[model samples]
Target: MYKVFFRICRYPHVVIGLVNITTGEKGYWWFSILHEEMLCEEYHVKNLKGVLLDELPQNGGWFDYNDINRI
Candidate 1:
């Protein structure tokens, strides 16, 4: 039951760098890098550092991946 929350310092999307902000694990760091690069070329307002998607909202909303693709 892992959950992620964002401080939302000054950005819309939270950027979870290579390091897992919670457990400090290693993986999906590329996601952060890619996001930064995107912001640079697209938004040009890179200042993201929030919660990762896989680590966010444990079904807090109406949709949860746990069963989405399972049918």
Candidate 2:
């Protein structure tokens, strides 16, 4: 599984959630107080960049593609 970055319509650096992608399944993980997770489809997601969850900042912001490659 991997963490997929997503930017809202107006906020470019903020990560609204993550997409957990596996062999043939994907799920959405909304990072919030409620901490929700749901199964979703690839097309249902947009503006995504694959990144390892461990490399992400706790505050949630932009991550360099190079960092992803290093993992």
Candidate 3:
């Protein structure tokens, strides 16, 4: 299973950060909250929580590929 960290952006937009606990791989993506459940299902992410905006990198996208690698 994967552990996902997320933060709500403007309106329906959500920034999602994922860590593959077993492989130590990480990634980030964004989508509407309306599809959050679907994302969890597809990713097999059973654990998820909200994070402070400050916890993320200061990038144009709120986060970047390199930031996720550090997470």
Candidate 4:
């Protein structure tokens, strides 16, 4: 068995929830999830609670090779 940890964020820098899994591989960051979902708005990306931005409405897209596309 392995220990695994997971976290959910309303936005990139915003961390909302975290959990531990009883079994899993060594901990690793999942930076590839951006493309997996068409949009992160469901997770409150637009209205991220804990995340703060230099500008209001924070009209920025998820990180990526380009880091410009909203989805």
Over 1-71, each residue of candidate 2 has an lDDT whose tens digit, in order, gives 45765533222223344544554334333232221111123224333445444433344343343343232
RMSD (Å) per prediction: 11.5, 12.7, 9.7, 12.5
Worst 10 residues of 3 by lDDT: 51-60
lDDT for each residue of candidate 3 in 1-71, tens digit (9 for 90 to 100): 44555444444655667566677676676555556555446546643363222223323243574544343
Please give the lDDT score for candidate 3. 0.51
Q: Which residue segments of model 3 deviate by more than 4 Å?
A: 37-47, 50-71
Q: Per-residue lDDT of 1-71 in model 4, one digit per residue for the tens?
A: 21212334334433222122332223222233342132245444643323322221233322332322342
CA error at residue 15 for candidate 3, angstroms: 0.8
How far off is residue 30 in model 1, in Å? 4.9
Which residues of candidate 4, in runs, are more than 4 Å off? Answer: 1-5, 13-24, 38-71
Better of 1 and 4 by lDDT: 1
**Ten contiguous residues with the weakest lDDT in model 1:** 1-10
Rank the models by lDDT, top first: 3, 2, 1, 4
Model 1 spans > 4 angstroms off? 1-17, 28-36, 41-71
- lDDT computed for candidate 1: 0.34
lDDT of each: 0.34, 0.37, 0.51, 0.30
TM-score leader: 3
The C-alpha local distance difference test score for the whole of candidate 4 amounts to 0.30
lDDT of 1 by residue, 1-71 (tens): 12222222213223232345567544321223444455445434444343234433222223222333332
For each predicted model, how many residue pairs clash, with residues at least 3 apart or on different chains? 2, 0, 0, 0
Measured by TM-score, how close is model 2 to the native structure?
0.27
